[model samples]
Target: MQLGAEDTKAIITRMKRAHGHLGSVIRMLEEGAECEDALTQLAAVNKAISRSGYALVATGLQHCMAEGGPDSVDAKKLEKLFLSLA
Candidate 1:
């Protein structure tokens, strides 16, 4: 399913934020930050990316269900796509 306009915008915003967060994690490592501190920031970045993936799947599922009848939606395909993120 094509991304709904709002979903696309939200996803882009999330990705951009994640990009900035990831840069911070990298910088922290380069600056000789404590291992624990750098790892914490890295975990935040990972969580952000995972959340974005979930948002994408959830939005696509909604779009597919709304645009096509229930019978037209492929549950298996969507499930695989969602699980791939895991």
Candidate 2:
């Protein structure tokens, strides 16, 4: 199922933030920033990306349920997708 506008926008915004974080990480590495600081920023980037992925999967699951409840094949697939991220 296609994502609703709000979900799409939210996921895109999160991804954009993650993208910026990743760029910062690269710049930090180039500048030989402290290892701990770079690692902390990298962790933030990872968390942001993970949150965006979860949001996307949640939206898919929500749409699948609305269309036909959780017993549907699509819902099962979405469940698997959600679990894979764990």
Best by TM-score: 1
Residue lDDT tens for model 1, 1-86 = 56757768988899899999999989989999999999998999899999999988888877777888688778899889988998
How displaced is residue 71 in candidate 1, in Å? Answer: 1.4
lDDT of 2 by residue, 14-86 (tens): 8998999899999999999999999999999999999989988877777777887767546467668888888
Compared with the true structure, all predictions reach lDDT values of 0.87, 0.85
| Per-candidate total of colliding backbone pairs | 0, 0
Q: Which 10 successive residues of model 2 have the least lDDT summed?
A: 70-79
lDDT of 1: 0.87
Off by over 4 Å in 2: 73-75
